[model samples]
Target: MGSTILPTGMVFASEQNITENSSYSSSDNVGVSIQKDENGDLMVVKTETKARANVARWGAWQYTHIALSTGVTAGAINTAYSKGIGSVLGIFGLPGWAIGNLLTAAGWTNYGNSPGNAVARLWDKNHNGWVGFYKRTGYDGAGRAVATAYKTE
Candidate 1:
């Protein structure tokens, strides 16, 4: 007899018969079956399955970078504003000048120099400083996510 072509592109010749104890198995998330048609022809059946899993996505890296950069920029701006305010207050006299100097120094230490150094490191491209900054931000974001998830539980 001539070979019969199955819908799945498998060809079965009439002389070849499926054994009675034929079995099918799948290791993946799928189902497999072997059956016979009305004409005693072997048929292979397959069932497709989709497996779903809840996984942590790394899409927050971009946001983390943006946030870090924004924080640094805002720090710089705030420091400059405070310096301006301090300089204006210094014109008032001795105690005012002392307080102004204190504010200026605090602002420089808290916002200006520290954040400026970070920004410089981020833009230095010659060194791996950018990687360090990005990695720190990524770690911070991942830590926050874990902490928040734990708190909700």
Candidate 2:
């Protein structure tokens, strides 16, 4: 576990693999401490945020596509969401997409959602014809967006 000091004197682990902003998810069991009295009395405040209850974060976004009509590319997904396919399969919305386009998954916390219905494809190094946007339902500790890529139209 890694650690950092926030301006308010809070602490967090670097293990979240998040940078550019300091943050932790609700699902992450983190604690913040406050001095109850100047005499050194202290209390621990725990914060937690779980992913959507209906879908498991680990089973949300796994995909590697060759193109529409063809099918999933063989090695794409394993290389993409390396966190494990089962953990990413259905976290976004449906089970699958049209036969042509493919969903691309990356580090969920790496990029921020673009402004106003913008498809964040520009930030994706492996970007294809990514287009057609959806509400970015995910965020990191800094409240930066972690959008879901559901189409490439």
Candidate 3:
């Protein structure tokens, strides 16, 4: 068996079993399983899956930044978590300029510094800051399959 990590962040791998003439190869989102069918003919199974996620990290000092930023309180974050970032912003009734300032001060790397981007991210469905979307489709040797996972974490 051998594997390679490509520059595009895709993974490529292959393995072979000489005795049974079976083989396998896969990349970031696709795979092929090659084996002999009952009739001793070569059969290939193709599988594909797609997924996406993102995260950003901040130092403990970020808390200091938020604390020092004007008009933003600890409760602000709590409110966003319990409700949504849009709700929190709505409660403030601040102008767009003020909202931009607030987010810039509190923003993390992956979260945007602008009001619209920040709200969409912080709300992130559950407000835990973890969001994911994925889809899987193709043959898995035994049967064809199609699935989608819109969110997790």
lDDT of prediction 3: 0.32
Angstrom error at residue 40, model 2: 39
Q: After superposition, how far is residue 60 of candidate 1 from its true place, in Å?
A: 51
Instruction: Highest lDDT: give the candidate number.
Output: 3
Candidate 1, residues 14-111, lDDT tens digits: the string is: 22223555533323213333333233333333332231222233222121232123344335324434444333332322222222222222222344
Q: Taking the candidates one at a time, how many backbone clashes does each contain?
A: 0, 14, 0
lDDT (C-alpha, whole model) for all candidates: 0.29, 0.27, 0.32
| Runs off by more than 4 Å, candidate 3 | 1-18, 50-153
Question: For residues 1-153, could you state the per-residue lDDT of candidate 3 as single tens digits?
Answer: 223333332222243342355544435324433433344433233333331211121111111111111224334544443444455555444322233222322232223222344533542434544322212233333443432111111
In candidate 2, stretches whose alpha carbon ends up further than 4 angstroms from where it belongs are: 1-17, 20-23, 27-119, 131-153
TM-score of every model versus the real structure: 0.18, 0.19, 0.21
After superposing candidate 1, which stretches have Cα over 4 Å from the reference?
1-18, 50-153
Pick by TM-score: 2 or 3, better one = 3
TM-score of 1: 0.18
